[model samples]
Target: MTYTVNCSILLTELPLLERPAAAKTAGFDAVEFWWPFETSVPTDVEVARFENAIADAGVQLTGLNFNAGDMPGGDRGLLSWPAHSTEFQDNIDVVAGIGERLGCKAFNALYGNRIDGESAERQDALGAENLAKAAAGVARIGGTVLLESVSGAPNYPLLKARDALDVIARVRTESGAENIRFLADFYHLAVNGEDIAAVIEKHAQDFGHIQIADSPGRGAPGTGQLPLGEWIARSRALGYEGYIGLEYKEPAETAFSWAIRA
Candidate 1:
């Protein structure tokens, strides 16, 4: 299983571009960011600086979580948010252009908390329609829009894997867009009682990328219940050759050297 690190956890002390060196030092081959646009919004000079940083560190840009306009404290949602539907495609166009410039090929669309008055069916329909629109634009840039399911609870909605699967299948079928897929995060699966490997196998075609954090604490893979090596083996057996993103918080250590085989 090839490994990539999300720079959000490590190098929290510096700019996004500077995180690559620390990521490389910690033995990662690729790096991902939640929202690079926030740090340097709409400026090619800053974008160029980030591109140079990746080039210098020799790390590939795995993917980016699309800017949901929350990094600046404006809102914690994306185009999937009903309020932003009209401007959603234009927003995607801007981000897709940035993705094209940076060589990243994947993006995430996470639906936040539920609307107070909407029924489950209405929300799902809106989500499918908006995501399908975004996916069409994403495909033009040779990137994919992955609909991520966070555990639904007091704090979030659309937390169920079955719900996300339904939306993805319906949208793909309706839009006839093929590049859209699912981003399975083990942390959410652990919270929602879904078997990680079972879900992957069940939705083989929709599975595109993965992120992992051990259950109970959302720590490094081996730090909790997840069997890292076995998962690696199973993923390969299942014909998954994409990046397995390491997105967990380290308590005190700079690298997960114990969990990773040298």
Candidate 2:
């Protein structure tokens, strides 16, 4: 029943380096983020500053995303894209180094959107290879690479739980790396029109990490109609012991009011 804040999404008001401390001030002992840097390979000074910020804040980094291409510009991730395979491969060590220093273990690899002319078969093959590389890269720290089902990006593939799970199976089979697992973000699954209760009933214990935001507007728990608390309780009841990441959008001042009320 532990909770972690996703600093990338929740603390948008603060500067990137400052969000870890902000999360600590808001009473979170653990936090997660998408790639904090703009480039796949940031400078040594940049890496040191990022690591130091989290350490200074006294919060544990529980999860992080691989260098997904320009998120605001609509680039979802680099893993499945044929052109950016080099950048994706280059980012593995940088991600693992940060994870090693910060004690973070879960690494989320966003499956990129389909290219205009590239066949789905090519993209799928490249994705599986890149995911295998990422899996091996983080295996040093006993890390697990996470595959997530996403929403809102029309061309982005892997919109359902089974889609991600199928890829996980492919990676394991082709690469023989057993460290890959599912990132069950309830909001996205619900938004994609999946059967949430049925998904949980079948694969609750299979998730490596969990993220939450209410659907329809992606707001905090009470701002939407989603039964977030109940869903989390069901996951825990079924043996999900990982952090419930608060990856919601809300004003920082009142972001946690629903949690406080609960």
Candidate 3:
């Protein structure tokens, strides 16, 4: 089993480029992140800075997210948001370029929250179209595109495991690319009231990536009530062979061994 830290959430005390090394300091060989910069269009210099960070830190960029507008302000993803379609297009190559340089093979395309005044049907249509479009580029790069659920945000379309699986199926059909897959974040599923084992028992094959954060507080495994170790064991038993992303609030003391071994 491989465990990858999510720098966008953990090790955030450092600059964007510096976070990779911080993850390494915490004993992680693989790291993933949200779009490092705010803009969908960052200059070549900025892109290079990010590339060098990962290289110098000696860690792999296992997974990445395409630009999703202002993440802190609740812009979950741009692919589905109509106002950001041009920005999303402008960002595809930039993101793909980063993945190519790192030899990373997974990309997470967040389906954005609903926009005001736009009908849900139209937004859903736009989301499917954009998902298909992103799928083509990701496939060309020999990588799989991921769709994940977010917690507490009803406006975000992919809030449930079933919801994400639906989009995965639609994107595969819409693009004729079977490379699309589900990103199963157990914390989000638990937050949304889905039974984890049931999701795995039924659709384990649909999950391309899995992330864990204990429920009640989205903290490290030992700090909460979630049976993450058990869940991880179950997922492996179900034949989930993907990376387990460590995406949660940093504990007061960064403990690394158990998470990796689990």
Candidate 4:
């Protein structure tokens, strides 16, 4: 598999509008992000500006996330949150618009963590409903809904490979469509105590998108314990053919070095 830089995590030192170009200069042909704007409801002009940036930069947008509120502030996701259901729905068209415009084929729909007083069943129902809508929209463009796991926050519900796959199964059943698939982020899985090798052997076919970072520090590969190159080989060995998103923290200048594993 080749590499696609996740601009949201890498090149943090550059302006948002410039990250795609930076990724390109770093030798990446594709990139991903977690909602580039504070609100998923960016104006048409704003969206157009981003589109132009990518065009001018000459990089393919591989994936994007639905608005998840404040990622750095511990907001796990928006769709599954009862209060943010409308917000999540409102962002769907905007997301799909950009995806269609950019020819991006992957979308990550995070399952919101539990609200203080809300029941899991209620939130879960909302997640299913919202994801069904999202799946239908992306399916129009032949894109896939990525069920991903997040780590570094205890409240985030989907932290394991099985956790993400279970949610994917539930969404598929509810939507009655097969456009949804697993987004296997190796860093999160390892930190959550999953055996990466075993997960790959069993669920490789379910993975529509894959991301990586070394665990323990969520830093550049050499700064952590994961044998990312070996695991990537394991993934390819099992019939997985997809871009591996470089999702980790590193100096923008040195970030591309980790792509050696790709």
Best by TM-score: 2
TM-score of each: 0.86, 0.99, 0.95, 0.96
Best-to-worst ranking by TM-score: 2, 4, 3, 1
> How many clashes in each candidate?
1, 0, 0, 0
**In model 1, what lDDT does residue 29 have?**
79
Rate residue 239 of model 4 by lDDT. Answer: 82
Determine which window of 10 residues in candidate 2 has minimal summed lDDT: 253-262
Which is superior by TM-score, 3 or 4?
4
Candidate 1: regions farther than 4 A off: 39-41, 71-76, 117-122, 152-155, 259-262
Q: What's the alpha carbon RMSD for model 4?
A: 1.3
The alpha-carbon RMSD values of the candidates against the true structure, listed in the order shown, are 2.8, 0.7, 1.7, 1.3
Query: What does candidate 3 score on TM?
Result: 0.95
What's the true lDDT of residue 90 in model 2? 98
lDDT of 2 at 165: 96
Q: Across residues 192-245, which tens digit of lDDT does each residue of candidate 3 receive? A: 888888998887766889999987888887778888878878888888888899
Alpha-carbon shift of residue 90 in model 3 (angstroms)? 1.4
Mind sharing the TM-score for model 2?
A: 0.99
Error of 3 at 256 (Å): 3.4
